[model samples]
Target: MTETSPASALLEVTDLAVGFRTMDGQVQAVRNAGFSLGAGQTLAIVGESGSGKSTTAMAVIGLLPGNGKVTAGSIRFDGQELVGLAESKMRAIRGRSIGLVPQDPMSNLNPVTKIGTQVAETLLVHGMATSKDVDRKVVEVLTAAGLPDAAERAKQYPHEFSGGMRQRALIAIGLACRPRLLIADEPTSALDVTVQRTILDQIGRMTDELGTSVLLITHDLGLAAERAAELVVMHRGEVVETGPARQLLEDPQHPYTQSLVRAAPSVAAVRLSPGAFAAPASQRLHLAETEPGSGGAGPGGSAVAVATAAGPDGVPPEPAEQNYAKTPNIVELKDLSKVYRIRGKAGDFHAVRNVSLEIPRGRTVAIVGESGSGKTTTARMLLKLITPTSGSITFDGVDVASLEKKALRSFRQRVQPIFQDPYSSLDPMFTIERILEEPLKTYKRGDRAERAARVRELMEQVALPASMLRRYPAELSGGQRQRVAIARALALNPELIVCDEPVSALDVLVQAQILKLLGDLQRDLGLSYLFISHDLAVVRLISDYVCVMKDGELVEAATSEEVFQNPRHPYTRKLLASIPGNELNIDGELAS
Candidate 1:
């Protein structure tokens, strides 16, 4: 563990313990966790959900929920004891001395108020500015946080701003008073890579100018290693390891820390294969005509196809004249577009424009871009959820727009969707058994006994226990819930699955499990996928081919290896450069 002298430490936490009062009883959240940050230094606490990292940060900022409190330990800020500080005195220090940038900007910022009013409130409360000059100060703060046209933007409400713009507004409020310390909790978890990098860069510049220390809370190991100087690994309510960022991540001693490093796709030198984890050999799938030396070895010492290589002339080699190229196309989008006409807006808004792509049999093709880039719009059109303003969609040699009621019913049964939020995707009122059995009953596939047997088989396929069938969705963890979602998608044994940001909401370990499961299923059953996501690292891990989208246009489309190693488009290159920890070399290979 890295140590900081008390004299030089800006925030020192020792033997800290926190608990929340629940209806059943008092539940401990953080226990015996300790770390110290020197003045102007940055520290990060990283762990999965319910790991107490965020709880620790809340305790330090004296903003724990009404039911939560610090049960034991010491909190000293600049040599002043804060553990037992009075509420009035703590309020005085909360925003003026210690600032906060919360995780979800939409939930944290008031929806009804204008952006300028929210920012001005912070300055006025801290006595940073007077009424006559408060609006100017708000513009200056927003400008410093990298918001363009700050004066004009300040007149808008939170809902009117984009995700990145809202986050910048939060930062402007947090640093309006130039606090001595700042606490940022998963500030960019929901943002695209390029925007995440821009936000972090702005934070670095502002903090350096003000000489402010930072306490960052996040679940992304690559992000933590890139932004912070020191690392603190948190497990179930305890500190497992702490050290210098690069040293700790490269040579993690704790088993938990090592698992995190292995699960992180951003830092892995090679793509994770089915054999990389503990899966039965009978479950592994192999592709035909896989070239020699084109794949990576898994933990079981078996080669798995990861990426297709280019030829000697920097062009992708043509497929050999074989049955592999003869495989039929599963889904095709030809010049598809969607234009929404607003009630007041004069011009029509094109969400997706002239997007054409093909999903081959038993292969994964991914659509990747930032928010409002029309990736989701494309997926929705392919699903037949929305009618395209122009162009055509063909499914298995039949045009989708020509399908009637019965034909559409058959089409829905042949194709399935795995949505992003597991919590909302599954019905909370239904048991796991019922959730899995509903589709079987809908199709009249078999009797009650047969449906029961199929439900059990699905649970086994997703690696969930049959005992969980009796439980509700609320009883399962995030990973378990996602496994249930995947099982539901496979219930009908569809030929193609549309996974929309399936693993983006999950942590590294759980995300690895989901990706491995998807790969295994694709191999076991000749399933095709139309995957949509904003994470290029995840796209690298799971996709066979990649389509880069921007402002509703297809910027670049190529094999996964070609897109990452030889990006031809400027936007594609920018996205690659934005991935955190891309500069670090791990195990003799670049992290990106």
Candidate 2:
């Protein structure tokens, strides 16, 4: 274990003010952000998007984007000031004394190079290893980063690896030089909960073994509370709260922190009804005991299934799904399967295997799993993006697989898709109005004036300002972009919408708002959603039914209540177990 004491300040940042010169003007991205990390201590800077959590990290490392400059502040790393350090000196310290594991591995790494080569480059850049032994050291670090078959995996490119494996590769590179301090910026945000635990555990073990200090920047309060010792809550470029993680979580003084705690699905109280009260503490069951078909009774001792809901900071109780008992099936899949043949001598890959599911009209059915679990593939097939090798799909009793061009186009208007990454999904060159209007134009729903009217209507529906209609996708935040995507999906008034990880990329607050918006929209529009995501907690929030997938097969399928109360499959159980802060409740009590 590493020694972490208040007496030893490994990193001391004081009154840090950072700004960026944009087309609009100087935007103060980080203002008066100050925190101290004791030697071997883990400090988390938690905030929503545009809250300057990442800007502070970038300022410390001298890696701020173009036009970004430190306006005021003192960044002292090991008693040495680094605020005005030259590029050469900063480069020497970077990766040598301070390593960085960025948010997205795909963007951070070279796509054409092999994983081993990337790790070797880090070691070589910092002179950590000689040319003769770099290859061997690469494998060692990759293995230490928790990549299986490190020797062989090192030779493969990032494209060959899964999202988790690629992140592990980035971890290998980040820890290759064994730096004194590591800055992990949302390192596991894009990953599933199980893979997230593995990656975080690997970092913990490495940091402990090397006695390295960690600066964790993330939007996940639950993750920060569990992993970090000290927490600094930032909002609108200012630090709102800074103290012991447990203390802040249990008795938050700041309103923002309190809202964060309430919004967090892991710790939020289960809202039994719109204004329902929770059951007594005596009636609540432990996390381990709440499995599928566990017969966990609710407030009146009825057999009502329960789920977590948004309410005051209290113990999460089991809330029941919304009443959709009379709704008919909008989509039905029977024995759906998809197979693809590799170019090499290897056998075919079964992306989806004998999966059968139903999405009732005006109900949400969520598919939850890790990457390559065939969740997205199933959604793609449902959207008719790809033809499945076998099985049948019926959209409102019509065989979707047998649809011709005109009929397929008509089917598309009734069923739309909201992708995972809104930044990439929306066209960059087009204005928000154009982007939303394109769908109506393609479907030829109305004239230009009518389309513009619909665009304004969509803005109102998604709660975006009408002034934003002229703004481009680049100007919008992650949450805003997703809202635009949702608006575009709704432009056709589609009955069934395929939401693929729609809220996964957003911050917790934005995520909560988006979930609320979806729920509200579902109630108002009677919209049925085929929701696909890796986040089970979010699934439990908005989904009526839950389907757990693994290795291209449906491991478990049940009502969200049944799955949460009594998960039957081992894979489902593992996924539930892997939820961040699963062991800790809102009251900071550890599950016995």
Candidate 3:
């Protein structure tokens, strides 16, 4: 990496300030934030969700929303001032001189247009290719961006491609003109670890080949520390610290930066002692007593016991020979599979194939895999959202497929879902209070007065202020919205909750907060969670046992400690290896 200096820097921002015109008044989004990126160097701005990282990047790229403006500062790219550059002039520099890979590929790529056309548009817009040769150029860029079958992939719409593929398409467009600078804003935030690594690797290779300076904006501290040569820590609207990536991460000077390192799952997991979930024997919840004549295992080898905890005196508890087999499973999937029939020549898509797992009562069992690995399909089957093809889902010793209308309704009350995107899962048209109360009303659990009181109680349970109950989902932040989603899931007093990528959309700090909240809730309510996620770092923190899936097959199942410390399967090891900054040697707790 080239050392950056004021004179030699390819992109330099000094004393940058950005503001947005809101209903209240001008609100400062970025304040005096400054950073410099040398040619062929990568610099990252890391912070929580509301921090000014994205705003600063948008300001530099001349892509701020209509309501936003660069109030003050100088953005000098390739020795030219850009803060007050004309719109026409900025347009010329945007695609031709400075490329941008936006955060969300689904929203960035036009759904109706073919991927090839999108790439071709950028090449044509920048005069990089003509109408006759644009198609070939499109294929060339997509292939360079690491898309397999580039020619066929180019003919598909945005919706047809997977998340990683769409991101590659965006990369193809971003680097089509081989710009001197690239701005990647949370480019891999929504992708799984393996795919995230692949995308970042591809970016590194492409940028290196073109000698492009990159300015990356992300909330992932570990990823920033691993991928960037220099790091800029942002807090609120200001840059708090800047230094070499390794030096800054190993010894973060700013309190906020320190907290971020501590809160990061990959780093924090190191501080968690083995058997972190183990509680005192007295506090452990025994969901069921040992059954007579039934040695230890439940039907079909489903039941498993919670990890034995230490006694009150800090002595390890004695192991019961038949304890695990005697325990009752809260939920079980036996040879469960789902097959979807395709309309085209493609016959049937086997989404889940004979996947079997058990979620013990009052414990979290996470199902983890890359996208299309059948993790989500297994979750949906457990929730009874879709009919299984040849297997059974047993909930509380009863087959879910055998549940009648009344029993199904009762089952619904005991098993609730917390979806991935809290903003989309919540009802935007309704207030928080109504969102929580609607479930109660549907089940006719209580009177209006009783329901109103329950709503407040649920809010307090999730550590949210009661004052926000009247506000709609639009009025709340991402974490706040997730809290509301959790509150609604708990309003019914469910014994089991299926959390599908609950904290994947949240930042490191908020992800830690939400995970802590879920842990506390489980301990207090004795709830069971069938957590589904693609993030192994997060799964290590919350899950008691983990089931690894790949291509609709269960590859490995073991305790969290076994999965993380001594993964037996090659696929599981690969997933662990893909985690960013997993090799860091940080010690001691940094989170509050």
Q: Which segments of candidate 2 are over 4 A away from where they belong?
A: 1-7, 149-152, 267-326, 583-592
Please, what are the lDDT tens digits per residue for candidate 2 over residues 40-85? 6799999899999999998888899989999998999998899999
Please give the lDDT score at residue 220 for candidate 2: 83
Best by TM-score: 3
> Residue-wise lDDT of candidate 1 within 99-139, one digit each (tens)?
99997687789999999999999999999999999999999
After superposing candidate 3 on the true structure, give the runs of residues whose Cα lies further than 4 Å from its correct spot.
1-3, 130-140, 143-152, 161-165, 267-317, 320-326, 585-592
Tell me each candidate's TM-score.
0.84, 0.88, 0.89
lDDT, candidates in the order shown: 0.81, 0.81, 0.81
How do the residues 114-191 of candidate 3 rate in per-residue lDDT, one tens digit apiece? 999999999998899999998898888998887777988888898877666787788788889988898998887667
Candidate 2, TM-score vs. the true structure? 0.88
List candidate 1 stretches off by more than 4 Å.
22-25, 105-177, 267-310, 313-325, 342-346, 428-430, 441-448, 583-592
lDDT of 1 at 553: 72
